[model samples]
Target: MWQKLYEELQDQNFMIIAVAMDSRGIEAVRGPITKAKTTYTSLIDCDHVVSDLYNMVNVPQAVWINEEGRIVRPTEVSGAALSLNLKKMRKTREIYCNAIRDWVTNGEDSPHVYSDSEARAHLPSYTPDIALAHANFHLGQYLWNAGNRTEGESFMRKATDLNPNSWNFFRQMKNLGNRLGSGGPEYMARVRKRSKLGNEYYPLPDMAGMENLKK
Candidate 1:
């Protein structure tokens, strides 16, 4: 989805940097990325550095950074994805892509672009718990990558406890998922627990036109 949009606007000096926030890195994302054949810059964050930087808790979140290195739009729920072919999701993709095109064409003058103050207002700052959660997540990633699975799992559990609201933390902690495969027993159990609390893993913000996102 992003690739098609990028091609439409790339000639106008637009670029999209899609980052996958997963501890498993390339092994987790190889399938969708390979099948998409995306042309835009795509990278994997083995330690979720990008997620920490943006304080993004959900998958498919995005921020708009302009040529001058300004964040014209701070992080928020994004509709862009590889195939995102669900009917509701396709509508979301279209809405977000159209907004991106408008922003690229009009630059700072676009209504789709947030003003500096508005952008700053949307900027997510870390609280004590979130900060501590990220710290634990990083430790877990380091330990896991260093062949210390036992200790890594311990710290990953801590991170999950510290910030139960972060899907990035939960999903990434669960072996970064198989992408196309079923999430096994433990993962299913956790998802059921989270659902009981009325929070979808990919909870959409209360955007006017996206009421169907919960579906």
Candidate 2:
């Protein structure tokens, strides 16, 4: 979906820089990128520096930055325009794609583009606990790189305990061969819980003035 947009808008001074937050390195993401045939600027964040800077706790999140280095939109769950195997996400994909098109064509005039204060309002507050969580996560990554799996896992667990809302931290640990029980605070377990609560993992964008696009 992004590649299609990149093709369409590249001539219009629009570009997409995809950052993959995979700790296992480029080899882990090479297969998927190859399958997608993405041509835009693609980067690997082994230390999750981008994730930390953007305050992203989930995969497939996006932050729209304008040409002036301003954040037009803060981090939010981003989906492809093309439908995946998940039929339930088709409507969401359509809405998301339309919003992107509107933004691209209208620029700052687009209703989807938030003002600086509005964008900042959506960003998460960096509390001391969250800071500690990030520190622990990076420390864990360092230890894991040093071939000390035991200590790494310990720090990873502490990071998770400190910031349970961060799926990125949990995902990194899980990818590193940490197996949690089905009832544990793993990805699937959280999904199931959120489903029961009628909560959407990717909340729909506010489409107040753009109601006609729904048709």
Candidate 3:
């Protein structure tokens, strides 16, 4: 989806820059990138700096920046262009794609484009605990990179404890083989629990009143 979008809009003065928030480094994303045949600029964030900067709590989020170096949209779950594997989210994908097209053509005039205050309002508020969680997560990444897996897992576990709602931190830790203990819940289990409760992994964007907007 990104490839198609980039191809369509590259000549239109629009670009998509993807940042991978993987603690395992570039090797973890090399195979997927190669398989996808992507040509757009992609960067690896081994320390999740991009995630921290954007307050991203999960994977597959997006932020829209206009030509003047201003944010028109804050980071939000952008499963539409990225969740092709999930057949159930086809409608969402369509909505997201249409919005992108509208924005590309209309620029700031697009209804989806929010003002600075609106964009800031859409962002998740950062609490002191969340800040500490991010710090622990970064330290955990540093320790893991230094070949100290045990200590790394300890810091990561503390991070999860600090910010239980941050799926990004939890998922990254689990992917790095950091199980809390014998009785600790696994990633799949937590995901399933959320699913059963109708908690959307990617919350649907509120497209209310957007139907009348030009597309």
Candidate 4:
């Protein structure tokens, strides 16, 4: 995806930089990443400081920061238009190259375009409960990945209790159960209950591999 966008913008004199939020360091990504011939700049923000600054709670979130250090669009997205390409890329695709090309060639005319208001409206609703849940979840994941399994599970359970509708949170719980069996049926039950609340937005674990969890 980065490579495609880099190519597109290279000819257009536009600069693009990808700040990776992956906890893994740049050395891990450099080998496969360097395989692409891209002209744009890219960096990794393992601590998520930049993501927090931009209020990007998820990956694939984009911000069109203008030259004046002002954010023109904070949530201009691209994945919506790449479904078919992504499907094809599943076999033989150079994602970054194609995407970069499209963006650079089309500039703002690309498939993903949004105004400031539109971007702001796309943000998560600012409910106190939800905000607190988000905080807990973030801390939980940080702790979980940092090897503080007990503390992570504690915080994650709190997060799930606050926002039972978050499939992602429950997914983490499910993973924890697999690892430590700390929170088993009870936590899994919360996942199912809340997953139902998410309806179409929620994706339950595949029954084939994870059916036992639901049982």
Candidate 5:
């Protein structure tokens, strides 16, 4: 998606500053990103600095900022062009690229231009719940790294409850459970449950598939 968007907007002077929300080092994503030759400016959020600032709850997430550095859009789904014919494409990031193209081609007419009130209205009342989940997920990461398995699992489970749609959160929950030797049977069950829910989210990548992402 970054590649497609970058290529489409390269000539239009629009910029996409991607901040990956991974705990891993940049080297982990460098190979995959390089393979795609993504030219957009990308940064690793190993410490999740940018993620916290933007209140990101998931991976493959993005914020659209204007030239003035004001956030034109918050952590919303990146717009990708819809392809009626490509229903079978797995893990399509091109949706974002398509959105970038439409914005460049149509300017204010693009769906990106929502007023503050308009944008706020689009948010579910459970947004704060999801935001809190994002925070707990980060806290879980910290606890896990600090060798507090019990506490980490507790936090991740909270995140999953707050936002069942976040497979990334559940994946972390699963990992934390596995490391603690208590998340196996239940973890497998939860993974399957979330996978079914995630299929509706489109471009559904399995827990293992997206676990390799590095910020």
Candidate 6:
């Protein structure tokens, strides 16, 4: 899916820097990337430096950077849906992909392109709790990488507790090992908890034609 998008837009100065934010490293993402045969600057972001810089909390969120190194679009749930199985998801991605094409072809003139003020308005706020969550996450990541698995995982849990809205923090910890049960009873429990807390595990993007999606 992403490969096709890259191929279509590559000639028009459009580059897709697809990043995999997996703490378990390249092995966690190698199969998918290999299967897709992606050629457009794919990378493994173990520490999630890109997410840290962009204030992303979920998978598939993306930012649009122009030739001048200016962000024309703030980070939002990207059109690169992992599964286009549902009709609604397909439509969302369709709208998103067309918007990208329109923006790339028309540049500044595209209606899909946001103005500086609009982009700024869409930027995510960095609250103190969120800041602390990131600190705990990185410290956990450092310790986990340095072979202190037990203590590292504790801090990672602290990160998630601090910012439960950040699926990145929770999901990475879940992916660290099979014992945590990334897709088991505990995972489902947390998913339900997210809903009760008014934060869907996978929230729909705030796009046109998706008004039915709960806020």
Q: Top TM-score: which candidate number?
A: 6
Candidate 1: residue 102 Cα off by (Å): 1.0
Pairs clashing within candidate 6: none
Between prediction 3 and prediction 4, the one with superior lDDT is: 3
> What's the true lDDT of residue 128 in model 2?
87
lDDT of 3 by residue, 118-142 (tens): 8888888888999999999999878
Candidate 5 lDDT by residue in tens digits, 45-126 = 6556665566544556666566676555566544321234353232244444555567667766777555677656644345
- lDDT score for residue 95 of model 2: 73
Model 6 is weakest, by summed lDDT over 10 consecutive residues, at 206-215
Off by over 4 Å in 5: 47-55, 79-96, 124-128, 175-215
Highest lDDT: which candidate? 6
Model 4: residues with Cα > 4 Å off, grouped in runs: 24-31, 35-39, 80-116, 141-146, 157-215
Candidate 1 Cα misplacement greater than 4 A, ranges: 80-85, 176-182, 195-200, 205-208, 211-215
Say which prediction, candidate 1 or candidate 6, comes out ahead on TM-score: 6
lDDT, candidate 2, 65-144, per-residue tens: 88898899888877532223455466566677778888888899998899888887887677888888988998997788
Colliding pairs, model 3: none
Candidate 3 vs. truth: CA RMSD? 4.5
lDDT of 4 by residue, 1-215 (tens): 66654554566667777776544356746866687655578787644556445544334556665445655455423332223345432422333235445544675675433466765665545456666776786787688778997898788789767765454455545554474332577655654564476532322211122222221
TM-score of each: 0.83, 0.84, 0.86, 0.54, 0.65, 0.90
Model 1 clash pairs are none
Q: Which stretches in model 3 have alpha-carbon errors above 4 Å?
A: 81-87, 178-185, 192-199, 208-215
Model 4 Cα shift for residue 76 (angstroms)? 5.5
Off by over 4 Å in 2: 80-85, 178-185, 193-200, 207-215
Model 5 gets an lDDT of 0.60
